[model samples]
Target: MKLLSVNVSKPKTIAYDGKSVTSGIFKESVAGRVMVRKLNLEGDGQADLTVHGGVDKAVYVYDLASYHYWERELGRADLAYGQFGENLTVEGLPDDQVHIGDVFRIGEALLEVSQPRVPCFKLEIKMEMPGFSRQFLASGRLGFYFRVLEEGMVGAGDTIERVKPGPEQMSVRETAHLLYFDYDNLDRLHRALRIPALSQGWRDAFAELIGTSEGAPKKPRAAARAWQGFRTFVVDKKVPESRDITSFYIIPEDRVPLPVYLPGQYLTFKLAIPGWPRPVIRTYSLSDGPCHEGYYRVTIKREPPPVDPSIASGSHYFHDQVEPGARLSVAAPRGDFYLDPAEETPVVLLSGGVGLTPMISMLNAIVHVGKTRPVWFVHGTRNGLHHAMCKHMRQLAAENDNVRVHICYSRPRPDDIKGLDYDSSGHVSVKLLKRLLPNREMDFFLCGPPPFMKSLFQDLRAWGVPEGRIRYELFGPASLLTEGTRIPLRKPKPASGAADFEVVFLKSGVTARWDPDYDNLLDFAEDQGIFPEFDCRSGICQTCMHELLEGEVDYVVEPLDPPYPGRVLLCCARPRTDLVIDV
Candidate 1:
């Protein structure tokens, strides 16, 4: 056996579908000897640590036979020695013959087989074949990943020698096949579990299979969607919460038990206006808790006129057009921002203005669940005139020993009392939070206007609160927040269809798979945790116009006027093919 080449590379970011994808998969061969470490070879690094780069999968070894096979299969002869992103390219140790726990020596380095190289999306990108990962796995010619048992200098053209054979004699190909394809092979599963050199992740998979075959417990699943498409619901009652904000309680028209949802989740509605050509869609937070099973409540504030006429507000239609006894097209409740009622961690619910909607839901759910987690409900508004649910907020704190309510009136009215109206006088700042909070080690949930959310997020991080703990949902674009937050609003909505189509947001550096659930690109981008600002969602305003960088799009809603040259109105556009939009 011989080592053909030694490959090394650092993580590199490249444009893919208009988004940036970083990977260490683009490896190039090294010239001279290099030091082999426990984690990786010299000058090599993995972009994401969760899946790649560890003591076990330290050095990936791909044999030339598999390269030859792929070259023939793909009808391409330009494949390089490090094409498969392997660190060490070799002539021997074909996957079918290389056994797990087998020891090998190349130059002065000693290594042991730990696992088969599981191809990720990076491999598909590397191979330039969209479904190559599945094809590679099914082909059963996957190369092996080895862990450094002894670190030493190794160079290209070094001779490879098998030091010891694995005790079980389970080949890499057989192990991979047994785990991914041979679910019914109980004996092989048992034998594979006994091999000590196999990675723990592989062991867990085999154990899961063994348990599944023997009637063991399965893992829990995520909360699922309640209904498909749209269902009609009647507005049973409307109550004024504040000067402008009103709460509407809507019950399912079928009078069935509504699907349970966690606190902080929002509901989308399709509103039919008098003169609009299409239905106006709006998303509102469920202001009430899940404990109220009979009806869902949305507290909406009547919005003033926008600076742009086409950016006409939806709240105006709700306040003026819709009323009790009106039927509305309601969709399944969905939003990634939510409070897990069962979690015992202390939480701080922070909000400003109408942002109090989701906070109210969370506070109610927390109290209803009866868990002893400490909660600090902090709210800010101009004064008593603008604040909603004052009595309820005070009552929740008065009744619950663990719950603390702190209200801040940014500009309190002359008539508003000192302690009775609000507990604090300024905006809800990190300095204010420090005074109210006992320590800095609690989960913080914030919602409000963009400025309010952004400042608080930056302040919290600066004060040493981990980003993971500082959860928030903003009123505007996720672009308003700093980079690396992955859209502070919520997690990207999962793709609805198996469609291979992808929309790349160039400025946002995000790629969203097309979901047929959305009628236009604007809604699809929003669902995928992208923030493309739009005032009129029906393509009348031209507010959501973005450059069409790479692909063609079809108009779902015809614009009021012709679009700009080379620009598409996202609110009216649906991707006709794979798209790259200059956001």
Candidate 2:
């Protein structure tokens, strides 16, 4: 289906003169006709079938291109009007056509149509234009939630393409109504539940609806016999230089066997703090290699200004408030950044301040495994006093002739030299890097603050390091790093001669014919208004995880997780054969 129109509008609250519009005015404002692609509706009440708080009060809607065509031709803006909380407004296409598991690629970014929009009371106020909410209920043209699938720059006029389509018989709108009005509708709910396209929040809610009264079925008692309890042990070590950062040695209570992990992988720990709304899960990189017995080390740096002020002091809360005896819920180690032991080329490990954690792990792995590859470790810190793991790093270097460590200090105190060796009195610069190596064949592993990372990357490029050899880690929100630099958009290549393929949506029992050159299963789904939940279209985030019920596919890039035995990341995965997908 070709796009007919794209519209966007920013939501604005209007207060009437002495009328004091409460819910009604908000509803009336929601009904206004605006030609905008994104519309943010505002109100303050519970909307039916909303995931986040205030979502019910502030509804956003988008009209599809097909709907937009009708709206434009008939000059019927109300058909696209609704009190549903919508941050985006679109015209054209049947609302039911968008499915929960589908992803819409707009510009360089992607958005998954997570769930259907739920109308709020504010519509009654905005509906002042006419019978807006009633018309919306009658027309069944509600908008849906778009979980950002891929993050990048976005604006109006950008084309939208579906990367994955939901099963045909079950529509997102149908699922929304089923969830909103009749959550107990077992038959429809069962069908929606089987689609796998549903969001995790909706899935939990559905599970609660169906199985809440009775606790989740218990595992066989025999299964419990296999459970090994965890063992706990603690070893405290000082950083020598940085007192604010400490490394803790961990010993599990059950003494259960822990799996070996890649050097740069992180472990997620779920902590329950008193007075907190829910258990908080945080991930920290393993600061050392898997060693003899069951011990792993993690370094904690005091956060200067904790993002959540409720915690009083950021790092202090994690350090002083948290106790060693507290049980921590843990996730298995996961990461894609690892040193390739087989590459005989010289390797360079770069880090700044607390970014040294993963680099230390890599260095430890290299030393422990007795790899003979030449390694150059370059570390940058605010000053020698702020440098962490100084003693341990120096000891490792002293023991290994193949390893060399260079420390750069931005600001140095005369007495700070007591605990540091191989120290440089200035910031790391391309000139210094050139002076140190003079050669450019090393595989660079760099991680640090955004600015340091950016400057280092630029210098690496100028030094002619191949794109494939340079790998880095993003410690925070992927959005924090400027876009268009890390991963450049691939220019759409001219279609190779078309090849016929079939995509079987297993749940729907429908097979769609596709041309390899013209159809990307994901994009085609969005064009037909199907949206799948996804993030990091580059296959970094495991958001768009899906199983391959049948057939083969080739991934455009390496995925974060080893492709689940039978699954592929739909965002970057392409069919290598006639395919059957579970979603």
Candidate 3:
């Protein structure tokens, strides 16, 4: 087999992992000979050395024959060489025929086959396809990695000749298949363990799997996993639910089944915009039921920019710029706020404005599951003009005998009729809630803007609702929760001697006293004009992760995903003691 193309690329900065990342996936075929080195091609670079770029995975090669299959599968004839982020596009040497430790000579370079490529999100970013990683693994056409045995110049049309086959009987295809699908086949796994050419990462994985296996690999604990980064999704359709709200129907471009998600969970999107230095990350609630097939829907409101310009705004982009056929980078559905299907207690879904998104998900899930428990979907908005999904909500309520729908419009338009358009004409308060439902024993799930959430949360407490039964989700900046719940509306007189901790920003040469009203270190730092990079102040994004040089911090709430060992997410952590941090 001959090399069809020699590709190389320098790390190119792109928006990834909720921050700006330099990736080497945008490789281009070099016209002439390129120097092949022990670690990587002369011009090539890997952004994260921990995952890519090592002697064991110095070069990535794909068989040119697979391009034909992909061209047909993707229905595009314009697929080019180096499109799969391959360093060497060869005419032959598919995974099934390439065994671990097999040595080959191409041009003047001697290289050894190391392992099959374990696909990552970079593949998704390179191909602009969501679910590509899973699909690639399932296809069994995985390419093999090569470690240069002799550094030499190689170029297109170099003939690849097998010099010597190693003693290992395990082929690249066999190893990957065993690792991915036939994981439970301990006999084959044990055989693979003997292969000397297996990559260290895969070897460690296999070792761990074997250690954890009692005839079968144990299920991975959820807490131990990190976000798999963004996957590409296509907007199949956009349905206008109301004047201000529209629902985007997204489905995997690879046609894979949607990941299992509970009702009320949200899908976080990493939106790439040309002018923005970093991709804007935003979370939108899944508006459809989990039982819905072929697609997942997220309802979004077109939020107008606030009078203050500093606040981030992506609603305008979603409503105006994004359209059908737009490719979107979407994370898996995730959120702590969700309805428990196992619960038998009555459910009360309360919302104001677009907070109804999650409520709709919970309601649809209950209806789809044919749950017989009582459900109340109560919402308040400006009027009929601003109300969204009313028809669908009414239909579900009508179909389900145990479900009730209540719409309270604070202001009615001139043409709006009382009974037909709205059930009430005032803001939904404790008195109004009592009058409508009269039962305080139901599980209350609240979501809305700060004012709505704060008022309802306090009113619920005052009306004797159990704290455990009352759940709420604020739209943004979770620090609002601390402000709404902990800090009193009126300023309190200073205590005789309240202990204050010192927070020293070593880089900026600034220090600030930790005040009780400060929600977190990030907040306090921002106030002191030392704004560290931050996104998703709720602690989902690790953009604000800084090294804790000489300090201790306590989290206001445990983060969804923990930071790296020596780093702390300032967004959620408060200075527990006088500390120094490397921002």
Candidate 4:
């Protein structure tokens, strides 16, 4: 295969569909040679490092030949090299020919084929075509990803010569087929797993398949072991954090040691209220450090619906109805939004309102772990009455000279003293941040309301903070960290000719017509008087997961973590075809 063009671009945030997303997909064809590095091209960068641009997926390559296929398929001649967001647009290489572990020399650099490129929603934005990602995957034209073996300069017209073939000799086509279609073939999967250069993600999937075939592993990270429906827990203590916020310390009835959860992880509680017909499942961040054994602390803000009294009744129930000694059904802690214990960089913890719950957990962890990394705890609330954990935070800061606290009350009371009770009196704006922050280079962790998060995200970007350095936790629906701007809604495609198509709850013995108004099957099921077990309706907890006995479903919003094969998270999925779910 011959390199036709070398494309590179720094990620740029764009306003699309009503969200702000940083995408590095708009690669431009460079005129001259570009230096390829271990992580990425010298001129290129990934928007999110968690999923993209690692040692396993340093460079993305697409076949220029496929552009011809897409040109004919789309009936458009506007297609160009690097349009598929590929760093290296080659002439001859296709998805079928490349193998995982195959090493090739292009220009002065040596690259190893690692894995198939998994398409995300960014493809739809780049192509300006709704549902383009599904089409791209279905087309089987997924380009291969490469890891840089040697850093060197590469340019257009460079010839790619294979220096070594893969150990398994499994073609990229076969791997994709095994992954998506022929996943049941244990023999083929075993062979594919032998490839040393195969990506961790793909390797994990293969291991899962092998494990499933030969009795699934007893302890898989994807599966919850301690969770069995929801066990009863006693609210041991109720301590008021603020006037409106309270901390509930809950202990298991068995009084066993609780599972160790990372700092910033949350516990999902299933609350059975007096008035509500169905039990409410709401997630609250574990406020206290894990060092405190036998019990978990959740700081909850008594949220009252301002415009309508119908919302957040769970918070209302927790504040008014629930008290010490109350039996509450609680699920095991689960969340991806956690402070990395391994991260050694200077930390900046920012919060607004009751968002300080997870930050306090992280801070306590930093102290407990004996980490001396410089920490800045900055918080914003209305006043002393609204602020929670003030004494605890101050005491922690006093104990650790490395930890600095800055509290900003948006509306301070007459009794609140400056530099004593509070540091400042204003909203947590960028101006205040600039003054308080020693530097803009620390690892920033932010949590708060939509408006607060939106402003801070934009401000951080403006301050040239790398997206990878900024981590955040959203309270609900994964909508707080808006990924992209809202594009015009596309017209719904006509339904296939099957008027009887409807979701069938196999065990529930209920069938319901699919409604577009309901964002997911969980909502639709609730509307049908069938409340399937659920927590973190955002799809993080995987509690609502059930067997997809038959038919197909599509995710309106993709889960934070993918569920195991044949299982669907009802919270985020909707019936695409008539679905038979073991609920």
Candidate 5:
């Protein structure tokens, strides 16, 4: 595959315009190509380009990683720095021809097509050249997202080489089309759904669409009953350390079929705190590998004062108020943070304080899967007393000869120095990390508080760890990561005067006026005494879902479960037009 036109536009807003090419580096991956041409807008008075070719290509429009190609091509060294709608603007390839696990070499870098992108309203704004959005939607050439297998420099004029063809017989395009456009085509969708390459997001999307279709196979009413209300569970477990952090073994009381989750996933618990009018929800990552029937484990750290009041209160409530016998309402597991067992490279798991939960899950999974790769586990904590699951980790290390554990204490107490099996007494500095894991080729997974995670990320980059191999998880909301990061977080400014928007809940028949400051659609509805079912309230849960009968909305965080066409998570979603929602 040959590179065609390398176009870029730096709009006042990160939103794209067909005019001047943006001044930034652009990175492109080899995938199915789509036809590109310029179009004229009636009132915007600007020429916008439209990408065509490929049926059911809705995937490409909303994918952030795929959009990196366009950003890199614009001369932006930081591919994740800029905001472009989609990445590569191509000409020949289509979705039906490409398959998952397919490896392609673009310039010197290697990428594997992991999954199809899911479209969103951001594309409509990016392609505001009259009917550009509509035409692209009709054409259905949504591009795909790729996982970087090998990292190297890429540029325009480089040929894309197909290194490995995917094993699946069906292309992502055929699956997307059958699921989205032709709901009546159940046979094809079900058949494609059986493919392991199909993502859980796509599967959930298809399930929603097909389940709502006319004359679709009706699942037993009992199956739907399982998900109707929140399930409560009471869990009690022991923590190895004497610190405030504790581990709990949780199992659903209703015996409901639990959704299988990945190692680095988290579950949001909704607690009914006394004196609080509404339920309080917080997210905590699972601390164990996947099990068939055993209880899932979670480790929680009690936060002391002087920190943010909200977090401190929440942490205190979980530790002090919530008891071992008390039942807690929980949402299904959700998150994109996961380790790929297919990755055979050396692994480095980094954690600080309570952030060790997910890393424990990953290490346990690696060991469970019997992966023989060299494993380096580095943990940082205030002291041995505060170290959250030190005993469990020590036991695993003792059992597995391939695993190596390194502990760094920021503040070592008199007892900590005598009792702990720590390798170092200082904080996790670059000097210690380099000495422990001399090779920089390992995949690095870091999880911690914002400060700790950020510092480690900077240190790893300074140590020359490739960007592709360095993965991280935000402990709180996506906003936390957006703050002071390379990516710009431009909160939409309210209009000069209060711009009133009429939002009609089509299903509930509740009409409300939305204020610009109360931009969150879900929050606006809740304020109006119209409660939408929500769990995380952070956009991770797909519960506060509503179909968009009319108008537009912007999603602040990428949903773990792909939204059904014209549907959105009301929590972090903001309306862009006078709206109608099926609440």
Candidate 6:
């Protein structure tokens, strides 16, 4: 192994997207010997210390082979040794071959591989290619970052020798691929987590992957459902909770004792309207506690007119068409966001507008346990008129000394008295939370509109709340979130214990087994090396929709907004039979 060039550069400001941007991704080859410091190379500095220039990422190393490949791939002859902003450009260390935690001796400096280099927008600017960062990461040519073990000075043409290899069986590309692409490999995640030299950020990311499994004991799979695929639910009563929100009490026709579900879980309903050819499915949060008084309750707000009026709103169908004693096919309660009623820690149920549905359930369940775990039920709406179940929430707080409810009205009505109707006249924010709550020891559970969810999430993070303590149920993709970035989750495995199936990707020409371990076709397809574009894997988005050429499939998650005609939302679908799909 040999060093072709040692590059160094300081942070520089540049204009991008009509704003000033600063980055240190522009390095120039240094002529002579350079000092390798604990945090960075001499004369090299990063603009951001939060994500860059840490002791673990002191040096960035890129292989010459990747540069050569990119030169041919981009049809550009202007590629340079330090084009990737690497402090070390070497010939022998391939991204796929170098294992994270591997120690190497280069000249007088000793270093160990910490983690794979994730390309930021700065890389796209450096390459003068838009969307190149995604392409670079997906290509698995992302070079690795290094932790300087011993700082020393050496220059170009220095021989590199391996001191020790990473004990884990994952390369730089493998670790990145495990995180970004092949994320479902729990075995690999655990393996990567075992490496002590792995960066703390990567370690935390891996820990979050298994967070749910490591938390409170979950109900067994067999005990979770009271009935199979879809059960007949008869609406015993439908009452308006507020001017805009209504609650429906549903019970099985046979009057079976419904299984007690975790609080904050949602119920999926399949509506077979007279005019519709197929069942229209929608998911709504359970508003009542998990005591299951022979019935399950769902609170819903009537949806306003959608941009496309051709498609009827599911909530509208529930409010206008569905009546008392109406029969509906409802799936059993499910969702990872649900909270076990037995938790002893301080819990915060935060919500905005109609988002209070799940919070109501959570609050009711905690009160049912009568545990003095310090519960805070905080909610916000436009006014008392817009707030649903205000009396019910207040009653719960009044009844339980451990529970405290704080109401916020962004724009309160004239009749809305501060003491009676609301406690605050502003939005529910971290500022209000800090004043209302005792401390940061509480675990926050938030469900709200995008803006409300995003702001509060970012605020809590900025206030030093741990990521695991701030839980949320987002209607859209978490990727669109600016701060407190969270990874979207899917069922770890297919809920069905049915036999394995086959799925064919027509465009990719790959016919592969639909492993029983895969929750949906998207993960199965990805395992087969057919990665289709996707967002909001919960089926809210149609990004993963594709044409189903042949065979039938069942939706593991029914998209409230259905995909166009024959196209299937691969993220939430599982093949019922041998299937062929146009990628």
Better of 2 and 5 by lDDT: 5
Higher-TM-score candidate among 3 and 6?
A: 3
- lDDT per residue for candidate 6 within 1-583, as digits (tens), equals 9899999998999998567889898999999999999999999999988778898899999999999999889899998878988989999999888999999999899999999986766887888875576567668898989999999986899999999999885899999876654433568889999999999978876765545334534431113224556788789799998887899988765443455566888887878866777776678999988743457899999878778755657888888888987889887777768776666888988999999998998888777766788888899999977889988888988888998999999998899999999998989999998898879887999999989988888788778887779888875545444544543333355545465677789999998767766668887787677779875577754678899989888887656467777789998888888888998
| lDDT tens per residue, model 2, 366-398 | 777577888888998876557787878888888
Ordering by lDDT: 1, 6, 4, 3, 5, 2
**Which candidate has the highest TM-score of all?**
3
**Taking the candidates one at a time, how many backbone clashes does each contain?**
0, 59, 0, 9, 23, 0
lDDT of 1 by residue, 1-583 (tens): 9999999999999987557989999999999999999999999999989778899999999999998898889899999988999999999889999999999999889999999977766787888875466577678888989989999999988999999999789999999777655543679989988889888877876776666455432221112215665788889788999999999998766443355565787777877877777777677899987733457999999877878775446798888878888899887666657786557889999998999999999999878867789999999999999989999999988999999999999999998998898987999999999999999899999998877888888789789898889888754445567655543434445664544589899999998778765667876787677777786464454668989988888886445456888899987688778999998
Consecutive 10-residue window with the lowest summed lDDT within model 4: 217-226
**Reference-based TM-score of each model:** 0.50, 0.46, 0.55, 0.50, 0.49, 0.52
- Cα distance off (Å), candidate 5, residue 134: 52
lDDT of 3 at 221: 11
Ranking by TM-score: 3, 6, 1, 4, 5, 2
Q: Which of the two, 2 or 4, has more TM-score?
A: 4
Query: lDDT values of the candidates?
Result: 0.81, 0.58, 0.78, 0.80, 0.61, 0.80
Residue 171 miss distance in model 1 (angstroms): 52
Worst-scoring 10-residue span by lDDT in model 6: 216-225
Cα RMSD to the true fold for all candidates? 22.3, 26.2, 11.0, 23.2, 23.1, 26.2
Q: How accurate is candidate 2 locally (lDDT)?
A: 0.58
Candidate 2 similarity to native, TM-score: 0.46
Q: Provide the lDDT at 321 for model 2.
A: 60
Candidate topping lDDT = 1
